[model samples]
Target: MAAILTSLRNTVIAGFVLSLVLILMFLNWGGTLDYNFCAFLVRWLHVISGVMWIGLLWYFNFVQIPNMPSIPDDQKPAVSKVIAPAALFWFRWGAMSTIVFGIILAWQNGYLLDAYTLGAAEGFSVHKNIAIGIGMWLGTIMWFNVWFVIWPNQKIALGIVDAPADAKPKAGRTAMLFSRVNTMLSVPMLFAMVSAQNIY
Candidate 1:
């Protein structure tokens, strides 16, 4: 138990194992369970990934980035050399996983085309599709920012890339700005997605 709790891989495996246990305990396989169950599972995974992604985003904004100036230069390497890079790995993957699961969930729920097309698909409620579409588009943009704008710049800022000395500061600023852009989008994106429950 302690080993599983302490090891991330083990912990994640345990979580999935528990989820399976719960599903088996409650759901009537092949009789009561159907596509809805799969949709729920994917939605659950999507929410988990989104939480990891946004939690780290907020941590960077509300904690790490803001507190960086106060950390002494000597202690900075702990954050820069070790912490930030590790966080970024999960951050980028979280974004990818969230988007992938989100799309799968939408498809499972039978509104993928409607949402993607901004309510143009027949039989889907325009309002609901618009709401979910807004969220999806916002999330997509955030994912793009994470992979392209932020990660590339962060590589330079963290000295992972061979960048000119004068380029580091600019790269850091670009990453921060794009991160802020995602942060700003998060609120509306969340509202759109959540509010869709009632709308649909």
Candidate 2:
């Protein structure tokens, strides 16, 4: 019992199982779960994952990369070997999850195409549609970079999985440059998303 509780994976799995049981109990007790509840859940998932993704992006740009030059050569591997790989794991998955949940939320509300097309009716308002469209586009680009460019490069750079030794430096620089590009776009992407709720 104590051993199970002490394991990080076991603890997380137990918590999830407990939460699932509670949700099932609520459903059995005639607590109606509606479309709104599902939408809320999807939105919550989006927000949580977005925070994790962007938080690590900031950490990389604002904290780790900026401080790298100052660290001694002997200490640098600790950051590259240990901290980076862990952070990258969360960062890439968070980006993927955020996009997935955002799509699910939009699809559930029957606005996935409408939002993508910037509101596709004569009576529709353009403000919210445009805002959400920009966010969606930006998120899509960021997701592409995460999976295709950044993650592949980072795997090489950190030696998580290897490539030619000569590839490491180039891969690392490419990942950092793309990350910086994403960081610059994130500000407007967030603005567009938040503004979509009210600006219309």
Candidate 3:
């Protein structure tokens, strides 16, 4: 038990197994599995992943980065080596998962392109279309940074790949700056996403 709990991989596997069991139980207890059900599952995945991504974004902005300079050099390694990497593992993957599920949801509903374009008149009511379009654009930009800019630099910063000593700090700063930019965009992104559903 102690050994199992100590290994992060084993712990995650165990947790997933337990959750699968519970979900199976729910299905047995009259949860109708259908397209809508599948869509609901995907949406749930999107929500969960979005929370993790944004949560880490806030953690970086609100807590970790601000405190970094004050942390003793020896102690900083624990954060950079263990904590930040772990958080980022979830962060990048969460961003990917959110985008995947969101796309799936839109596609399944037969509005993928329309929503992307803000539901241009022929396809949807004007207001709702525009609102969804704004959210899609924000999500796209966030996704772009997550994959193109942030991940590459983080690889260097975390020393996941070999990098010149001087290059590492530069990479780290670049990643951090883009992450802050994402944080700023997230405010409006979330607002437009939620407001679209009801307001328009």
**Predicted structure with the largest lDDT when compared to the true one:** 1
Q: TM-scores, in order shown?
A: 0.92, 0.83, 0.83
What's every prediction's RMSD, in angstroms? 2.1, 3.2, 3.0
- TM-score of candidate 3 relative to the true fold: 0.83
- Which residue pairs of candidate 1 clash? none
Model 1 C-alpha lDDT per residue in residues 86-124, reported as the tens digit of each score:
999999999999999999999888888889888976544
Residue 39 CA displacement from its true place in model 3, Å = 1.5
TM-score of 1: 0.92
Per-residue CA lDDT of model 2 for 33-126, tens digit only, reads: 7988788778978998899999998999999999999999999999998999999999999999999999998899877887777676635566
Superposition error at 53 for model 1 (Å): 1.1
What is the lDDT of every predicted structure here?
A: 0.92, 0.88, 0.87
- Which regions of candidate 1 deviate over 4 angstroms? 28-33, 121-125
On TM-score, the leading prediction is 1
Error of 1 at 10 (Å): 2.6
Worst-scoring 10-residue span by lDDT in model 3? 120-129
